[model samples]
Target chain A: MNEPILRIRNIESFYGPIMAIRGVSLDVHPGQIVSILGANGAGKTTLMKTVSGVMDPEKGRITFDGQQIQGSEPHKVVQKGIVHVPEGREVFPLLTVDENLSLGAYTLSDKGQIDHDRDLVFSYFPVLKERRGQEAGTLSGGQQQMLAIGRGLMANPRIMLLDEPSLGLSPLLVQEIFGILKRLNDEQKMTMMLVEQNANAALELAHHGYVMEIGRIVMDGAADVLLQSEDIQNFYLGVQEEGARENRRWKRKKTWR
Target chain B: MDNAQLLISGLANGCVYGLIALGFVLIYKATEAVNFAQGDFMMLGAFVTIGLTNTEYMGLPFWLALPISLMIMGALGYLIDRLIIRRLFGESQTAVVILTIALGFVIRFAAGLIWGHEPQTLQNPLAGKEIRFGGLVLGMEDVAVIVVTILLTWGLYVFFSKTKLGLAMQGASQNQLAAYYMGIPVKRVQGFIWALAGVVAGIAGILFAAKGSVDPTTGLLGIKAFAAAVIGGFGSLPGALAGGLIVGVIEPFASRYVAAGYSQIAPYALLLAVLIFRPHGLFSQVRVKKV
Candidate 1:
């Protein structure tokens, strides 16, 4: 098999004294969309933070394009072409849409290329183009999410680490964004690691997927295989077998623990 | 007619106050800490210029001495940010505030030890020169003060809006972490901001010293400048200039129309009124933090 573009092996990270990610491992190959699915407190955000150099991993190795990048600063991580779209759409609220996108290309010296990429981002979300001069804070939740993603694209990232792109978005908006994500993957061959709680949407678009629970990956497989799995259907997809509805609560408690 | 003359004189003086207040506003925007030592920085600028111009010292011409002193003060400002202010960062706001107050004391005493307690006059090219417009007489120093303040303020406005480095500084001020994430060298940008503030302080000092005499305690005028900042809006630049003008005009008018005591209390009274009514100042935008 070809080498993965990004790899995390036996990585552990802590938030103060609390261990948020405990010896988790994952691989994202070139031109593949990898999704990590979990509930709240499942350490999905922590894993993304460690990869993007926002948080230091206490143990194990993180390599990007064959370079050790576990302890690098966030800015250095960007220079390596790995852009992180953090949870909650951290768009610079006061800056105009144009300025935010301009800042996203801050590391690049080529002004011409920066402008070209900005045009590309505008094509992906025409609304951002229309409101390009307005403050990002004035954007709606879904538009802000689009802006955040558009800002990431302005960096011309080789790979994107997206945390909860579907959060606080309507179902139709989620589908629209996911469609864009799929297009980026298919046409541009962009590698992405998407961490999300929206399992069905994420799994539907991802090439491969991992299920995390309590800072550990409990299951991982090809997206189609996981979607077809009875365990995934019953637990995550909310599909219960006939005559099994009465004992479902007791079964869930036993299975989760 | 008397009010018109007072207004002109007050505006000139207000320009000086506004210049000093700009330093406060700039540093506060960058670090969120009010550097009480900012006045002392201005004092140092004047002293450095005087020292360099003295025959026993460098004895350089006014033009030569000016840039040299400004560079020296800028470096001092950079060092202060790196060695002292940076260490106090992420600590409580009150702790940083008190540290700056202490810094002011240290700078004041250091100036006294170096230059002695007596006041010294600054040689200015425009000193003792005046232009007459009809019956009114304007001091060359007053005109210099107004001209220099306008130029400096305008220069700053251009720098913030037009330059890439200035835009980076603004980005850092708004959100340091986000700026860092965007691959901006935030630490270096912050150091540059401090150095730039220092350079501004030096220019203000020279202009101020040209008007009269300078001493170690000359830095104490920074208090009134602080009042100007509050009157304008703490974080706004144009507000600082406008605030300074208001304070400057009111003081001279109050002393002439009301009493000498009223001049002394005028700026503070206006400050209190503003705080009681429109706390955001005349030109400040009201920023709301989102959850």
Candidate 2:
């Protein structure tokens, strides 16, 4: 019951000469919200890209449902039921919202399944159904982000890799989106790997959380445990007690890699 | 200038340019490649029909020859994409642009070898036919051009805006990386676009040949068609046709009223004007993202 659905072992990825993600390992179990918390330049997006087969890892292995899938093409990875919702919500600006969602279901040949998936997406985000025919670019940033998420849901993916869902949104919108994500996880039992810089919002919603730094995972535990840890509060949660930073620096010596 | 007569004649010629511009826009949209060989594809389409319908050749009826010629041209476009364009996929677009420019010369030479350099016309049922309405006479060939262009425009519009595959293609064209993430086979969609461009080029050639004589050099008209595409915002579909009509109508009127030589340069002059005024061209505001 505890078996991980997606596993990565010491995967390395490069962009030309520079290594973007170096020797990273993580696991996402079924029907759980796994959050990777990091600041900018922490290789959070790179990890998502590598797992989705958008970037072929230079070394190590990625197994999804016990099958090696590290170097498969993006479309092939999608066919195996992993959908990547990219950073910056790159919905086709000129295309209608309906068109974008239909494209997300590109791997599905069953018309009935596609319709069902689209209906589910609309139900989750009723605003999407209202603006279905409108060009995606015309939508507000928050609406576009929902459209991006709804578009990803069109695939009926086994595990969805979400890159910064809270990015560039108002705090209220962030809470709204995370609430929907929590609902999706609980009601549909949808598994998700969420990468975020919004540690407070992400930690609140995630079942398990990992803190990443400079292309490596520095700390990981149950979301509540990580939230309560003194070192995490000082570093990620930005709690400032007298000499808390000094205490974190001292504690770093004992933290596991 | 006789306004009604010139308008009809101009519209007929405009339809041919519009059809050719349609090919340019179709290919350019799907793949960022600016195919300099589009005109030569047009030449090949006209020659294929001539070879089929002419008395000295296969002598197929015009109706039968039309579809057969379209299929042949479509196949040629697809093969060109699979063998040549696909090879140039990761290479700089300049490589493709140069290759297609060279292909234009090669295609023309091949057509000359097959059909000879002398001007040739299709043996068709529509030849020399005319329609008279309130003393406004129009060639049946001109009428056919207008009718066919409308039908093709409607058909392509429906295909692109309404169908799943078409929407996928439009998505792929706008952003390949995002498109790939959505499980679109971007490369395969591009190949289909080339095939479509070929079919469109064929239609333009058939209409042009029906209206007048064609030779190995007839492909030079592609420059005017290219100008039409520029005048229509390169990012938009409907803009392409409007651009073509503007160029086509300006041509005869420019010659009749302004001067004879002006007709040849009118489209280019208008193109320059559009570039100065609306840099993104008319209709569409989106600037095509450069690779």
Give lDDT: candidate 2, residue A71.
91
User: What tens digits encode model 2's per-residue C-alpha lDDT throughout B36-136?
Assistant: 88988998999999999998999998899999999999899989999999998789989999999999999999999999999988778888998988877
- Tell me the DockQ of each model, to 2 decimals: 0.53, 0.52
Every candidate's lDDT: 0.88, 0.89
Candidate 2, lDDT over the whole model: 0.89
lDDT of 1 by residue, B30-89 (tens): 888898888889998999998888666567898999999999999999999999888986
Q: For candidate 2, lDDT tens digit of each residue in A51-135?
A: 9888899998999999999999898999999999988888888888999998889888899999999999999999999999998
The worst-scoring run of ten residues by lDDT in candidate 1 chain B lies at: B282-291
Error of 2 at B142 (Å): 0.8
| lDDT value, residue A61 of candidate 2 | 95
